[model samples]
Target: MILPVISDIHGNLSALERVLEKIDSDRILCCGDIVGYYTQPNECIGKLRQLKAISVTGNHDLACVTGDVHGFNPYAKEAMDWTKKVIKDRNIEFLRNLKRKIQIKINDVNIMMVHGSPRDPISEYIFPSTSDSTLKSFLESENADILIMGHTHTPFIRKFGDKLVFNPGSIGQPRDGDSRASFACLDVPANEVKIYRIKYDIDKVVTAIGDEKLPSFLGERLYDGI
Candidate 1:
């Protein structure tokens, strides 16, 4: 089975639409952060709902839906507050009801999905630079053949023993100095993972941010991918 996984879509509907259009897969799994940062929170939520994705609760999603922006950075906090006010009731409810982690068995491989590390799940930041011991502990705790996560907005794939940990990167906001949308396709039958980067109209998203009067920094970061 070919599963296309996406994550960290911070309310950039245009980018999400483009990514969805380009990916062809049987199932869509989102790692969370469905709403935050960018404009069009309602539209993004609508599109995600239409796709019927199995989603986990991202920190931004939780903050926006629950009106608890304290955990976010200043810029993120400000943007999330604006998004919370602008998001529709249905969308907010959707986010409020999302799970923090999802475990699925596909083709005899145990796949665990979370917004961050399995240990802390929604709040941890697990990156490439993260300690190997920490990653090992997380895998041991989850005991999954494959672990997928997103949070730092950087794409990565790490293998510890026979298990694999992968991050498909951020769809809306990529901090890896690349404005392109990042995603991953897991070929369960082949036991292979492929990372993909697709270019979209960043200028269009930037324009939409301005039109929506979202955080000014959001528009500026698209070009720099910060």
Candidate 2:
């Protein structure tokens, strides 16, 4: 099976659409934060539902449901408040019901998916800067051949012995200093992961943010992927 892995799509439907259009896969795995940064939360949620993506709940998604934006930065809190106000009732339920972690086997490869680290599935970050000892600990703890995660909005693929841990980055708000949308394709039969970056209509997203009266920095950061 070929699966497209995506995450951190904080409601920029244009970016999500572009990423989906380029990938051909049997199923899509999302690492969450489906809604919380931009203006099209409902639309993004609708698209994911249409695709039947296997997803985990992100910290932002949880905040939207609980109406608690504690620990979020000022900009994220503002967006979360707006998301709670604008998101449809059913979509809110979808986010509310998402799992914090999921384990699945595809073609005999045991895979684990989470929005953040397995230790703190909804909130912890596993960045490229993370020490090998820590990453190895996560892999050892899960006993998964491949551990897939998001939340850092930075794409990376790391290998420890035969085991792997990867982040597909942020489809909507990439912060790896790349302005393009990020995703990954897992080829189950071959046990290989390929990362891809696709350019979308940043101007359109920015214009929509402006139209929605969202924070200007939310739109501005997309151009630089910061």
Candidate 3:
């Protein structure tokens, strides 16, 4: 089976829709932050639900449900406050129900997924610059053939001995200096994962953010992919 892995959607339905159009998979795995930083939180959640995505809770997802935006920047806090006021009850419950991490087996390959790190699933950031020793420790302790995580919004595939760790990047808001939406496809039989970047309607998302009166910087950043 081909498994599509995605994360950090951040509520941009335009980007998510475009990414979905390119994927052909029976199941989708999400690393979380399904909502935040953009408009259309409900629509985004609805789409993921339709896909029956297996998702983990993200920091923003938890913040939206619990009204705890601590450590959030001014812009993020503003967006979260608006999200809390406008998000539907059912969708908030969905976020609250998500786990911080999950594990599954596909085609005999053991995979562990989390929004952040193995240590702190919901709020940590694992960048490509992280040391090999630290990553080796995580892989050793987790005991999975493959580890998947998202939060840094940068796509990468790394290998250590026979094990692998990868990030599918952000679908809505990419920070890898690439404006395209990002995702990864795991070929279960082959035990390989490949990253994909797709162009989407950013103008539509930016316009929606303005219509919703969200922070302008949020939309501006999408253009630069910063």
Candidate 4:
């Protein structure tokens, strides 16, 4: 099975649209943050629902759907508030119902998917610099041959023993100093993974944010990827 995995899509429907256009896969798996940071919360949710992807909720999704902005950063809190006001009721319910993690078996390979670390799936930031011991602990606990996650917006594939951990980065708001959409595809049968970066019209997305009156920094960061 060829599965396309995307995560950290904090709104930015245009970027998500672009990424989807480039993926030709049988299934879609999302690591969440479906709503946050940018405008078009409802539209993004609508598209995700249409695709019926297997989605795991990220911290931003929890904050926006549950109206729990207190734990979010200043800018994230603002975006959550804005998203809460604009997201449709159905979308809110969808986010609320999303799983924090999912496990599936393909071609005898145990695959675990989460928005963050397996230990604390919803909020932990797992990046390339993360210690090997930390990765080992999650791998042992999850007991999966392959682990897939996204939260740090940096894509990488790490191997520990016979286990593999992969992060597909951020689809909407990349923070790896790149203003491009990032994702990954797993050829499960072949046990091969390919990371992909696709460029989109960042200016158009920025203009949409301006027209929608979202936080200016949200629009500005798209250019710098800060």
Ranking by TM-score: 2, 3, 4, 1
TM-score, structure 1 vs. true: 0.95
Which residue pairs show backbone clashes in model 2? none
Determine which window of 10 residues in candidate 3 has minimal summed lDDT. 185-194
Q: Residues 91-163, candidate 2, lDDT per residue (tens digit)?
A: 9889988999999987688899999899999889889899989988888899889999899999999987678
RMSD of each: 1.3, 0.9, 0.9, 1.2
Clashes of 1: 0
- Candidate lDDT scores, in order, read 0.85, 0.91, 0.91, 0.87
Query: TM-score of predicted model 2?
Result: 0.98
Clashes of each: 0, 0, 0, 0
Model 3 clash pairs? Answer: none
Residue-level lDDT tens digits of model 3 in 1-226: 8899999999889999999999887699999999888888999999988889999999999999888888999998998888888899999989999999899987678899999999999888999988888788888888888899999999998888678899999999999999999999987776789999999999998898899888899999999999
The TM-scores of all predictions, comma-separated, are 0.95, 0.98, 0.97, 0.96
Between prediction 2 and prediction 4, the one with superior lDDT is: 2
Candidate 4 deviant stretches above 4 angstroms: none
Query: How many Å off is the CA of 33 in candidate 3?
Result: 0.3
How well is each residue in 62-125 modelled by candidate 4, as lDDT tens digits? 9887777765778888778778888888888998999998999987899999998888888888
In candidate 4, position 12 carries an lDDT of 84
